[model samples]
Target: MGVATQLVVALAIMCAVLLAVAFFLLPSRSNKRKGLIQIVVLGDLGRSPRMQYHALSIAKYGGHVDMIGYLESDPLPELKAHPNVNIIALPNSPRVLQTGSKLVFIVTAPLKVMLQAWSLWSVLAYKTEASEWMLIQNPPSIPTLLLAIIVCYFRKTKLVIDWHNFGYSILALKLGRNHPLVRFSKVYEQLLGKFATAHFAVTDAMGKVLRSDFAISSPVLSLHDRPAPLFVPLLPSERIAFLTQHELTAAEANEIIDGNTKLIVSSTSWTPDEDFSVLLKALCEYSTSAITDSPQLPELLVIITGKGPLKQHYINEIEALDAKQELEMVTIKTAWLSFEHYASLLGVADLGVSLHTSSSGVDLPMKVVDMFGAGIPVVGYSNFKAWSELVQENVNGKGFTDAEEMAGVLKSLFDPANNQLDVLREGALKESKRRWDSEWKPIAGRLFELTT
Candidate 1:
């Protein structure tokens, strides 16, 4: 209790404080280590393009990246070829979760989370070397966020959440907002969200919401989606070869090759957020308009891409229409395409359609970005505020609310006489120049630079 003893205790406390500050501020300090970044997604690696782009950017700058996700589909060819990138495939979901009743899902949800938690914990805590940072996709955030928070804490890693959309908003689509599970998810997301070292929002609106509504104290960056280098417009000479060699059957390809049929493309997850009914009903309306109302409109070959739960339901509807053979002005085709093929299709297609009216009003869809990057004009569903950020009406793209409106947009854009299609394609080409690497580089360099 002497004065000398009190001074010694104070010095010990000061030393402890300095060590704690050094531990946390390492990313901002000049002595930053190499970015051993871990990028995670609960969904398929191929389906999640934004996170893949993140991994690609990290690796492009000489950082070592560990991308963890489901390998349901193939990712970009360059991602596989990158020597600095190591992709760790997560274990598959329980069979009951994939093919199950609503009641069964309610019963199995906890078990699914537990299994996922165990897998992630083992991989993050034991299997992988200590990392400097982690960038994880949010949406199926239940187990991802929880495991990330714990892993980052123990590993002394910085946790970053790329806010594409809220997990609760997606779940609320099936379970109402008032549902207890949905309510719990929102609370959990917000609580854990504040723990992130930083945040990357797909739109400026999303960043604002994170700071004001979610009360997130960390720095939030508006890092909008941009297409990777693979997505580019195919040359006029390449069209015939692409159609013949790739996804489209020869017969389907020949229809457009031999006729004045316009090829229109749309990519969807085939989920409730994207009501394929909107596109389907619009096609029927478009057929009527293209025939009787707008004869100037070209005949259409519509291709909808990507796999989802509702895909088969929409396919059945199309099959029924085909069996009836009542609609002659437009033909419908669907394919679950690889990124290479998907990019090529976008490049060659005359127009792109997006049915994504976001579950959270703040998100911008990456499919629209891909379309623009491929120099294809888009007709996006515009119920959400963020749609304006990417789809500028009459500029790079147009926006529609209902089937009738979408049909009208399609008819006008596809009409050969108007020259509107060329105008919009030119605008999209301008947007295409604003590619992902340039947008991602400055941020990636600063964040992942060795000895920051």
Candidate 2:
């Protein structure tokens, strides 16, 4: 009785164990359904060219993106009916709370380091089953990022840190190299890299800096800014007419150009860092030379758009250069506009300018892409490697080192015999399509992978 009963009991137990294993391993019908990816964009919602590009990319790829940040006075209209996007507004108090929390880190630096490590361990314990979390670069609150890293660890979610600019570098440049905040930022960046699953650098140069400086082993992907695709067809004639009409009708434009204007446009949020004053100086110099030499010289019309904290400074600089008489400054207050309207304005401009100094680094500005899409020639400074590569010499545009060169480039672009305008227009359209087909489509594919 003992041997037979024992054998039967052992067989039954073995079968039960096998059944349990199968139940756990076998795929369920629910697992076959489409996957959902939820992305939290921690940044401002309005007047961000980069954010707009990312939102459009995610929307096109079927991923759900939620943006949490401070709201603007005039909210973006495009964000309203975006199918796969959600904009969450953070209260003012949270920002103050987050800022106050950082004082603990500053005052008790060594103790805070130990506390942060302990907090990371505790957070990682709770996040074993969540999806990946990506923290976009240039976070306004450093404390918030520290907390996000802890949450990412606990959730067992992959962490992606997108680096737009090296905050430490910016700080070192503005302040001294030995500034405490700059040094601390570098340390925090290294720590982030050590913990992050992946990294995205806005430029190849920035990626190089991260690898060389921080010794970060994580896979760094270059997520350079690519312009939004233009859905509207290219209408060259209408664009020309728009510019011609604006110059003729607008008293400011007329005063600047004195009818029969040679249109040169630039749209930027005139910041001290942008060096728009150089552009104004160049424009004024060109106007003065033209008036003295040729009585019938084409009226040089410069249209400047965008408004920022430095708007008054830029206006004063323009007035100082006597460019106010030859330039029309159009300040943009609203955060949103239809793509059609933006494209139409861009298309009308004969030439577009994007000039920035060494402090700006190799930025892939959204306006550059817009110029390409609108088939407008762009002239700008060439300190940026990315800009140099894209804006080929005598192809799309010319990148200058100084204001004199900038004016010379502009003068050349206006020459009727040069016929460079036609060539540039064709090249820009080709480049725009190339960007969409290559960079943007791949990004869309990546978003699809995350979502489904």
Candidate 3:
């Protein structure tokens, strides 16, 4: 507030910066590691499966990896145990960021970002083993992309951006497209996004947008998400036990054990991007319609897993449906599962449902890939053009436009007379043969100059 106070704050920052520089200049720390690849994520390292895959793939290919991010949850055990992988966690968010008032946010957002950027720089410049290449995840791209650009410029490291989705578009979801913040984020990303040494797009549609819209000169590749080796069919015993403990009542458990119920699984972050109400309405309709079907349709046991701000909102909606006894034919269970448990549950599911309506219409849901990896076909919302890239209608999976279509597809797939579910299951098993390592190798082999 006063000149002396401001000068003291500024002096302390200068001293900290000088000390950081001096510490890294020491002979032991000065030997910048050769052939080490840095993987940076602004989000939680454990929740970010794609970046974890990047680290694991590098380690698997005999390259050393330094993964930097917040360690909010445990990453894959394979990555933790890898001899070549070293995880460097950044400091968690500052306390001021947790405020509920808009006025407080307006005053504190910049301070929070400055704190975050300083922490990131500490890891990049001091904590990590300096490498020739740094791969960063986007969509939390505000200060992260700028920080990476600055650090890479100073250290002479090649910066790589893994574009999961447009950060501006995500911002626009809450603040409309015309919001100043959204516009600024768009300009910011476009201006700095071109500085990357390379770009990895999650879909080809995104690749086209980068090249044509962003006018990026660097190599842009479509590095689609594929299932890690961890996703596989759970053994029958484990599946039964899992359902019995968490999902089914005693009678329902007996029904499940007796093969009298169909296990349907869907994973959602429960955000506006994914309209979960569609899934619920579809289930209610399906339950009511199936009550009078020929051969008496197998009761549906639906499990939904994930956590988000809208979770309680939807939980209340689920409760309301239950009050009316509208969900009699279908029993819905919701849980926030660990990554391992999520994978296991998907593995044992009879069918998978995806309600992901991409905000940009170009980004694909990684959850669908996980489900397919578990050898279960998906019933995805088909409105987005990119859905075809992952979910092939009547083949490995089918696509639906609304509740009516989703209900109809469910009935046809699960009906004992047609055996449609078996056909899709076989197709999914075939699709599961395509794994992440095979997809990662060629691009990584080229990017890092490694022989695969």
Candidate 4:
């Protein structure tokens, strides 16, 4: 072989290398296509406000969004009305674990995961574009995240997990903390959480847990739930109308204003995590106490909103109390209200109470957020880190550990002369303005950047 022949071979090799580099560096045809974001929530879509808010946020940017979730709950009208959003409703699967015993959950874990994987895989299989993204809401079924991770891996799509709470912590409420299934769930959650392209925490404390427990160095964003657009403070007339519409007679409305009666509201999902009994027990304690000689401590009109599995149990307890007719200091009423009605109640109520202690000890309750938006003060049970973020003792709201403490908090708030409730109402409004005014649009914008 001659030197000239060797030179020709080197030149050909160099040309081939340059051509390969160009092909690799150049943008693919997928990037040239319209960018669309996909969101898959295995949980109840109609019930999950977080999922509804996420869909609305994505639509704000005029980006196309495809939402896939269970049909157990009703879809948000706002999401349905959005031109850029397409909600894919799947038949609600029987959640054997959530409603059944620990033994049932453990026994059905394999089947549950397989079913979820198949549901997710069926929809994800149609994603034809690369660099597409999916934000998944988690907790009741943790393995759904694992399924999303696998689907994303094969499709080269970006995967984001919005961690509301750990599934194990919730499972522990039914199964004891020492249950092997709970232990396995905790391990699985932490291990799988790290595989996501990014993580969104419901609270800062939740983000820390992801870091400490999961060792997730992935980009974690704290995307807290805020008040919906409809949660504004009510006008005097609007408040009266809301009360009247709910069977408050003109005389009763006058009594409320004259300090002969007061309306207290609390919203709950009726889950084990939310101990509604705590609020009821507190009301019982408050009713028995002769804290003041004046009748103006006000005969209580306690309204509890939300529908859940335990709703019937609480309703029966309230009815039994009503049957006794001995507790004249307070009257109990339970309602499974629509968001509009719920927001109106929050807007008109004098005080709001939250019995949620954070099922995971990390996720903050959105009920307090809605209350704050309506300029209603809250007295929520303390879980220390998560609930404390919103209910800053005497700032926007108060925190209690037990029913006795909660009763005491309620007593002070109901005191007509103290003017403490007025100050707390103002604080709640101020905090709500500061927090919710920021909006989820910017947060969604940052999340969309993950696709880039």
On TM-score, the candidate that comes out on top is 1
Models 1 onward score TM values of: 0.90, 0.73, 0.88, 0.86
Question: Tens digits of per-residue lDDT for model 3 on 1-452?
Answer: 65533543565456447546644563223345678889999888888899999998888777899999999788888899999999988889966475545445444555666677778877886677668788999988877897788778777788899999999988677667876557878998999999999999999999999999899999999999999998876678987787677543344776766778988888887777888899989888888877765446788989888876688889999999999999988888888777888888887788999998887788899988898889998898989867877887788899988988988898888777778888899889888888998889998657887654
List residue ranges in candidate 2 displaced over 4 A. Answer: 1-43, 73-78, 92-131, 139-141, 230-233, 240-259, 294-297, 323-340, 358-360, 447-452
Residue 51 error, candidate 1, Å:
1.1
Q: Which of the predicted structures, 1 or 2, would earn the higher TM-score when compared with the native?
A: 1
Candidate 1: residue 255 Cα off by (Å): 5.2
lDDT of 1 by residue, 1-452 (tens): 65433543454345445534534544322222356898888889988999988888888777888998889989888999999999999898777666425555555666566667666766766567778898899988877897788778867789889899999998888867876678878998999999999998999999898998899998898888898888888887787888777757455777677657888999988888998888888888888777777777777888898888888888999888767764578788888877877888998788898999899899988999999889999888998978888887787888889988988888777776778888888899989988888777766557556323
Taking the tens digit of each residue's C-alpha lDDT, what string does model 2 give over 1-452? 35433543454445446534543453222211133333333344555656656656666666555554545533345655787666655433332222223334233333333333333323223322243444445533244446456555544455566666665655455445675666766787677666777677767777887688779887777776666555222565665455456533244444433335666666665544478767876776667656665344456656666666566776676665554465322221222234555666666666788865545375466677778767777888787666664677777777888888887776666655567877876677676664543664554346446432
- What tens-digit string does per-residue lDDT give for candidate 4 at 1-452? 44433543454345446534543454333341245777788867877887777777777766678888887756767888889888887655555635555455554554555456555555655433443787888785554766577667766678888888889898888877876567867888888888898988988999998888789998988888788777878988898787776663344677676667878888777888888878878877777773445454668888887778888988888777667653568877777676777788888888888888776788888888888888888888885578766677777888899989988887888877788888888888886674442656567566685222
Worst 10 residues of 4 by lDDT: 26-35
Write down the TM-score for model 3: 0.88
Ranking by TM-score: 1, 3, 4, 2
Off by over 4 Å in 1: 1-33, 247-249, 252-259, 450-452
Best-to-worst order by lDDT is 3, 1, 4, 2
Which stretch of 10 consecutive residues in model 1 shows the poorest summed lDDT? 24-33
Model 2: lDDT to the true structure: 0.56
User: Model 2: what TM-score?
Assistant: 0.73
